[model samples]
Target: MKNLLYILVLGLFIYSCSSTKNRDFNKKEITANANDTVRIANDSLEYEIIVIEPGFNLFINSIAKPRGYHSQSYLENKNIFLVQEYNSRVNQPFNYNPNLYIQAINYDNFVDYGYEVNYMLYNYFVFFSREYNQRFSVPTRI
Candidate 1:
């Protein structure tokens, strides 16, 4: 009787562990989907900006200003300043979190990357700053 009880308990423990592992795998898939990637590109200008972060899609849809709210020039100006500040941080990884400031953004003021590209880039910087609790020298108000 004692031996039978031990065997049953051991089997239940193994089953529970397997179930937990499966649940964790499912959770990871959901999390991956949530961490969306947004790409903004202008073929004629040959410029592209890719933003990969969690909750950014939600932020842009719900929190950010409408697409045509700001003029193209305004978006470009904000993007230039924000990109400069962000790239500075990326260069000095010791001063900033390396994981957060992953790569330098190549944004040229002379290039006309269109209204959509500029708007998305500007909003991305805003999202990144707010999400990571970072502050730029220039204003990041939406």
Candidate 2:
């Protein structure tokens, strides 16, 4: 009985130490939004990025082109709708990427315009897939 008890205690000690020895994470700490900081440390290079809070409009406008302006097709596929609208509605000639219209939805404050452009591209892709010997899935965008 004494020998059996010694073996059991030794086994438990070995198991406990071994289980915790291989763990990857040493420590993790998260600061509150007010504090607005993140810290990570490991064997690799330490990385830290400052948190900046800007208004949504300012952030969007910084990356966004002005409304009613367009970039050429060389940059992206041409937007026929924008071209037509520019021709008939504004009577202005411009060449721009269709993707810009997609980006415009967020910046232009035009929800309907964005949806229309998305629908047009989606249908155009579907129509092309049917006519041509090719297949394309609509991409999931962030």
Candidate 3:
């Protein structure tokens, strides 16, 4: 009983002392204007993107399919890497607010592996931009 009381008090103390700087993700906007454009330069990918009218559709009706649902063990650590990579590579957090037509992706449970998922996401953004002519800029990074 005494230990439990101590633990509860310690927990409250730590919680109260923790910094709140990163807690308000609500301040960030997930949606962008059709005309909004961003330049991305990162180790995973480099590209320029225009937000484009009507936004984007993430899932293309191709024969290819996403990896089946993932188990928690397989997702460990890789989830953090994927989020970090996704956040870094996307001009905005597609993980947070996917573009216009893009479907809500199950980022946590969707992939069999990390690299493939990132590759697919980066290309899909490019594909959406090119196919729609909604976004244009140039050069290349792969």
Estimated TM-score for each candidate: 0.77, 0.21, 0.23
For candidate 3, write residues 35-81 as lDDT tens digits: 33332334443322223333333333342244444333443444444
Ranking 1 against 2 by lDDT, winner: 1
Model 2: residues with Cα > 4 Å off, grouped in runs: 26-142
lDDT per residue, candidate 1, 1-142, as tens digits?
Answer: 9999999999999988888654567778777766777777767767787777778888889999998999998898888888989999999999999999888888888877889888888888888888888888986564
Question: Which segments of candidate 3 are over 4 A away from where they belong?
Answer: 1-102, 108-112, 136-142
Q: Best-fitting candidate, measured by TM-score?
A: 1
User: Candidate 2, which ten residues in sequence have the lowest lDDT sum?
Assistant: 103-112
Order of models, best lDDT first: 1, 3, 2
Q: Using TM-score, rank the candidates from best to worst.
A: 1, 3, 2
User: Of the candidates shown, which would achieve the greatest lDDT relative to the real structure?
Assistant: 1
Candidate 1 wrongly placed segments (more than 4 Å): 1-19, 24-27, 30-35, 139-142
Q: How accurate locally, in lDDT, is each candidate?
A: 0.84, 0.36, 0.44
**Model 2 residue 36 distance off true place after TM-score fit, in angstroms:** 5.9
lDDT of 2 by residue, 1-142 (tens): 9999999999999999899767655342222233432222232423222222222224224533443353333112333433333234223224433322222211122222343243333333333334443333322331
